[model samples]
Target chain A: MAVVLEVEGLKKKYGSLEALKGISFKVEEGEIFGLIGPNGAGKTTTLRIIATLLTPSDGKVTFLGFDLKKHPEKFREKISYLPEEAGAYRNMKGIDYLNFMAKFYAKDEAEVREFVERAKRICGLGERLKDKVGTYSKGMTRKLLLARALMTKPALAILDEPTSGLDVINSLEVREMIKGFTREGVSVLLSSHNMLEVEFLSDRVALIDRGEILDSGTPQGLKEKYQASNLEIVFRSAVQ
Target chain B: MKNFSHLLIKEIKELVNKQLVISLVFMLFIFNFIGNVTKSEIKKAMAKQKIAVLDLDKSEISKNIIGALNMANFIIEEKSGEKEQVVKELRSSGLDLLVVIPAGFGQEVSNFRPGEVETYSYLKGISMTGSRKSEIVKALLQTTNEFLSNEYLKKKLPDLDPKLLKAPIKSREFVVVRDRMAEGSTSAVIGSLYAQSFILPVILMMIIMYSSQMVITAIAMEKQNKTLETLLTVPISRTAVVMAKMLAAGIVGLLSAAIYMYGFRNAFSFNTGDIAKAMSGVAPILKQLGLTITTQGYALFGISLFLTILVALSLATILGVLAEDYRTAQSLTVPLVFLVLVPYFVSLFADINTMSLPAKILVLAIPFSHPFFAVQNIMFGHLNMLWLGIVYNFLFVVVMLYWTTKIFSTDRVLTMKLKWGKRKVVL
Candidate 1:
């Protein structure tokens, strides 16, 4: 598979603290790659850098062979990023939010309507599309955000803590949606603290700790390498 | 290009969703209505004065004086009782003024000696209200003196030329600038009063209330919603986001200003003829004060106001970045309002040329002050000061924009922590 994203020697510092320390990674097309870590493991920071949200102190990132610094607009056009605990304008209805997202892709009104309909069905929004987002539950808002991210049908989707606040059912639904993306030859780079989510959705996993990747492989491969039966034990052993 | 268009659409959508546009329109309607109503009341009150006449002489000359006063717009009320009743009324504030003609006034005047007419009013007892009434009475007496002199010359010197009796020292009052003279009509006075007491305050209120809160809340909202991070991830430059926000704010500010001005004009039943005449004289004065507004002065005024608002909004954005929430953003507006009001108060109390050096410096430093000063200069025909005001206002806007953009571009604005009084630190 073609490499959809590449990062080299990524380093970021905030005052006296180093959030990212010369970290590097690659995400291939048609793969669900998860960066799993603890609460302060810099998973979100890494994802932010990959999404072009933060400028790395010393590093280079290229998305689909386009340098982030040189062609950020082009890279943004090809990818959709959902930050951790992402929020939508609460006063706008779900469908309006969807249409608003679709506008970034230059989709006509008719195209937006059709796209929102498809996204709504896939996200199981149903009649809730007419209600203001402020009235939505945490899981519902997450679903709405996921639906909006998918509406553009970009080649690469970057999701940070995509199901952090979701219920089990919504989490499973999100997992299914992410799986659907891989089936359609689209790439995904997801960061999460949920080991179970990582084991279930990611075809490949990178266990990161303190801004550095401790280990990288398939979930089962990481478990086998650490001589553990589960990815959780592998993560614990790797961190130690 | 497509993404920029999308960004603009999303901004407009968010602005609409916030219901700011609707609220501003409503505010404009209500404020304008109140301003116009107040203006009309003031105009009606100033139209004419009521005067009390005490004809102690009961002579034809005194009667003729009373007749002339009655013919002129004064509501003349004759006191039938004694001098005590008239004096009591004047002191009690029941009468604006008392015109007391002495018993021998007609015989003395016919003998060619100066006839005395006494006017009485309680000056020190009452406040401005009583004082203004006394001043008006004094002015009427001066007019009466002039009329008496003219009448005496006409009657006694029938064979002599009337022009020869005219004073040797003839004074011709030529206004330095004539444009403002045309606005001397009733409507012009009303319009100017409205512009001062109503239009200026409303404009300041709208600019401070909306621009300060809106700009700050917009930035803080993005931060709270975590959308700032998402937007930062986009390929667009960070400066682009700031520019987009400023542009959005400018649009909102201009829209609110237009709505307020429109409502003001419509609600007041503006007399266009008076405004035109007033504006003509006002134009040259405005030019002198550093503002050159032509027949199309309204357009220029609108543009200057828009630019001034944009500068204010940009400053608000910078202040907003320092705020962590909507409430903090709102509290920040108080100082902003004080800053805007300083210039207005200075313009009100001090003349353009005679303003204290510090006041002049402060006014020159503030963009909004120039507009206030320029508007007055234009209306009053102070041409020399108008250009200086316009240039200073323009420069202030430009400098503010540059500084605000710099502050926005720096990461310090986004990450800086705010410290509260003594106990807590707010982000």
Candidate 2:
């Protein structure tokens, strides 16, 4: 397998506080790479840097052989990012919202329509897709947003806390959708606090805490390395 | 640039969602309707005056004077009740004036004595009608004096022409500006010109203020909802995003300007008609001296006005993105609003041509003040000043756009927060 993204010596600072300190990671082609950490553990900061939403204070990031800093627009063209608390324009219907976003990625009306159709099918909102997003339930909105992120079929999907603030059922559904991405040979870099989710969806995982990556390996490998039964236990032992 | 239209459409849809278009239409409709109603009432007031005349002389001269008054605005009601009764009715019936023609008044006029006509005018404390009624009294006295003068002059020179005795000399009034006699009412011409000078700036200020708020609210909403992050991550350049937002705001601002101008034109249309006719006669002379506004002048004004709005939108978008939510964003707009208002108020009284050096410098220093001068310059045909204003506004927009685009292209756009007192919040 080829590496789709490489991050070396990625560092970020917010005034005196270092959000990400010299973290390095990579995602292989068609692999689900998860960064598992606690709140404020720099998982989001790292993912944002990868998404090209933020510039690292000091780092070198290469996505598909393109220098992220020098060619961010080129990098951005091949990736889709979903923030933790992503929201739609409340006034727009779910279908309209998808179409609006689709226009940014698709080449023509036909492609935009095709993307919308695929997103609608993924969301499975049916009649609810025509309703304004402001009227949709939280779960429905999250599903729609996830569907939007997936519809573009980007080379890499950067999801920061994809299932944050979701119900158990919604979280499970999101995890399933992320798993489906791997089957399609799409690369994913996901960050989460839920060890179970990271273990379930990620082919390989990095245990990060306080802006540093403590460990990185296959989920089973990390569990075995920590002499733990599950990833929760592995995460606890790795952070300690 | 590929996603610019998409982003622009999204902004326009949001503005529609906010009911901005509907609100403007409703405002225009209601304002014009009210204006028409007020104009009709003013016409009615100007058409006539109601008065009660108490004629104690009971002579031919008194009766003739009453007849002359009746030919004009006076609706004469003969005094039959007591003075208190008439006075009481005066307040209720809206009678404008009460005339008490004293006894022996005709005999005193025959004896060449100055006979007094005591007039009691009922004036509402805050009403504009008081001065109008005073003018009516002055006219009435002048007419009565003329009748008395004609009687005296006829007897003094029975063979002479009455018109010649009435007016020994004929004089025609002309307004002299820079040693040239100018036609048209100086009051009306100057009044309308100054009126435009005052109102255009205020209108531009309001449009910029309102449209900037709309832009800020839109940007702040995207920031709060985290949608802007998703937007920036798209393939489009950051410059496209900033430009699209500014364009959308300018569109809304222009629409608002159109609505406001319609309302303003309608509200003042009745007054401007008379002024326009007065101005039309002298317009050629005014234009010869480059004192009248031309089509190009309006075009230039429009350009500078639009540029000023762009500058405002740029500032608003930056501040809005720097704010975490609407409350913070609105609070951030206060200083900008104050800056705009300072120019608006100053332009009302301060003439830039005669302004003190410090005051002129202060006015020129605030970029918001330039639009006010743009109006005055075009109307007065100060092309040099107008050109200077356009350049300054263009540079202002360029610098601000550069700053806004730089902000948009950075991580700071996502992390920037305003710090107040001991607390700091991400915008």
Residues B70-187 of candidate 2: C-alpha lDDT, one tens digit per residue = 8867778888556566767777666767887778888888877888777788876644456676677778878898888788878878999778976889765455554455555566
Across residues A128-208, which tens digit of lDDT does each residue of candidate 1 receive?
889998899988888888877776677888999998878888888888887886787878999999988889999999998
In candidate 2, clashing pairs total 3
Mind giving the per-residue lDDT tens digits that candidate 1 earns over B350-369? 56568778767766677666
Off by over 4 Å in 1: A106-114, A227-231, B32-69, B72-138, B145-168, B172-217, B234-240, B266-271, B277-316, B332-427
Candidate with maximal lDDT: 2
What does the lDDT come to for candidate 1?
0.72
Residue B180, model 2: lDDT of 54
Evaluated at residue A93, the lDDT of candidate 2 is: 91
Most TM-score-accurate candidate: 2
For model 1 chain B, give the 10-residue run with minimal summed lDDT: B174-183
Sorted into a CAPRI-style docking class, model 1 comes out as: acceptable
